[model samples]
Target: MVFSWRKKKPRSFNGDKKKELEIPRHFLCPITLDLMKDPVTLSSGITYDRESIEKWLDDGNFTCPVSNQVLRSFDQIPNHSLRKMIQDWCVENRSYGVERIPTPRIPVSSAEVSEVLFSIMDSTRRLDQCACLDSLHKLKKWGLESERNKRCMVANAAAAGAIAAAFDAFAGESVDKNINVLEEILFVINWMFPLTEQAQLYIGSQASLHCIALFLKSEDLSLKQNAITVLAELLSCNQKYTQALTTIDGINKTLFHFINKPICPSITKPSLTLIYDIVSLSNENTTTEFINMGLIPLLLEIMIDSQKAICEKALALIDQLCETEQGRGFAYDDALAMPVLVKKILRVSELATEYSVSAIWKLSKGDEKALMEALQFGAFQKLLLLIQVGCNDKTKEKATELLKLLNPYRPGLECIDSLDFKNIKRSF
Candidate 1:
């Protein structure tokens, strides 16, 4: 069926006389030389159909024949009108020709582009106003539309120039003035999770823990480092933001998942610091969950493998854990395994002896059998060695106190000692 559709002609450049332009071969794909085809996406996510075009794209050859500049995704084609025009031209040409072909469209002009830009800016401004007024209903509606708009904007080039202006405005002082709006902006950038997807997307997956994990997985080290700093800040005021961490599945999963990843020395140190903070906030339920999930083993592994600073942080967490009744229960429950744990602690290169001594002290408060077992394992020798080796002054004081508790006294000696030693001195 033949269909008649009105086609918009390309705007002409200023000149007295019209000239017929010759199409460049470089602009044509060698295999298809008739523009490009199916537009298949490559493994690397770049889109191209022709082998030569794909090679050029892969080899960092990114320029529009029309624009003569580096062609980013949006720069290649910038608006729906242009995109539709290209598709229509392809269809029309195929109807009249024996060869199946691809058609390319011309880029749009600046002034027509400005009108679209103003409309988007106006819409964004309205949404921002709604967000400022806490109109979640309107915000949600506009937010979804904005995302749809993003897909188009990402595919368009001329539209992008206009959109860049909107972004500049979005990032300007006016948006900064609204703290809530700014927070909303951040949430959007983080890809705000719906309640259902929140668990699987953020909590269950490793990337869900922090945006940094995503960046890290993608090998964006700078973004990953920035994320760690942000995580530190998030955890620093954990008392205020505890709900955000625990209530969100992704946040909770991400925090725990880090325990299992190969520790980066840079991240490990800060991670241990965060662990200490989490331990400090531990309740019976949280501590039990931590213990049940093998937190102890992971922590012990870290202590044995990590640097002194990390080991110290681990020990501090253990100290805090043992201070709680539930934590004491965990210690006692794992007391049968105490000898093995102590072995690992002793094997640690840095601060092993110090942590071993502390572990012994903590175990002493566990079951009687555990205490007796600890003593039998030469815990006293380890403790004394730590003290003699210039262990922290506090550690020395604790060792002295524990030694007093472990020492045995004879009944007869106690009586003789209680007697008036000064008065009996002459007789002696």
Candidate 2:
């Protein structure tokens, strides 16, 4: 069995047509060790697949993966020649089931973004506005091409500010004249999240808020959804802007309209989320406005209709509403509210359970009917089950207290033994 090393023969394919093909080392991304579909050169003179390098940088990496050198800058110049070579190689290896990578479109430059923005604001004429909107649409389409392009769009302060200003400009225009432009503006803002505070201020300004409020009135479901989302973002950015939103004529009523007859699931979700954000602020006047607009009954219907995150949000909002005497009175009196609230515990998410229990606890205080209703609805079973299964400490405490409150009413309730009662007594 002895063999000489120098006498070994090279292996043959032996007519095996599906033999593995070799890929050029240069065509592989250094980071991923895979073929580079879109080779891009970094400022450190290292090459990587565009996605690989962008992800590395986006995850807070500042050094080259191979050299460990600090990246001087983040500009990623496309290696077109290498990309074309990879494409040709893929075409040459079509028998191996290799697919050619499509050419990537060039990202829009800051100058181009500025030009379109200038065109948009430099004129008030409808025809000119329409043309500018077309240009802006093309730019947006480019930005949608890749995260690289989105970063380019965000880096340009002028472009971001111009977009916010465009909203203000269109806000003042007659809806018949500028609704299309307004829609595009909302689209752009939605794409550009984490907007600069300055831009947020501009969007939250009186005029911009007015435009969004007006958008809610439109028959366009998509527009109304976008408006609600943008409005929600604006509220989160600055609490001061909430007063302006509440002051808008028919804003609360418009929100309820979407809640009642949702055009689509997408529209309904965000509308409910926006309501959650608004009511969570706990502004007396705003809350009163919501109550006056019949928010309680609408919320109950929405709860019956939705589950998952939307239901969680509905429950959270209800928790806030129940803090007020008026809201509590409305909810407690509703035949559907108590049972629905009780059923949510141990049923939805832990957060939903907490919200439901809190609302029930609020209603139960100094209200014999509320306490009686909860026990009659098997609240004791759900509360005991919540404690036996793990929940957050605050939630467990609330459940414990509610159990204690209801214990005198049900002496034979099985879950609360001597140890449980002792633990609850000691926690105080």
- Pick out the ten consecutive residues of candidate 1 with the lowest summed lDDT: 419-428
Considering every candidate listed, which one attains the maximal TM-score? 2
Pairing residues by index, what is the TM-score of model 2? 0.81
Q: How many residue pairs of model 2 clash at the backbone?
A: 0
Whole-model lDDT, model 1: 0.45
lDDT, candidate 2, 1-428, per-residue tens: 32232243322212235666777878888776677878999878889988888888888978877777898888889999999999998898777767788997776777876777677666533435677588678767977787777777777776666677777777766656777887888887776666667778778878788888888887776777788778877776677777677778887778777777777767777777777767766478778888878888888877875758778878888998998999998997789998789877755688888899999999998887777778877889778878886788988888999998887777543332233233332111
Q: Over all chains combined, what TM-score does candidate 1 have?
A: 0.41
Candidate 2: list runs displaced more than 4 Å: 1-17, 20-22, 43-45, 109-135, 277-294, 384-397, 412-428
Candidate 2 residue 99 Cα shift, in angstroms, is: 2.5
Candidate 2, position 35, lDDT: 78
Residue 127 of model 1 has an lDDT of: 45
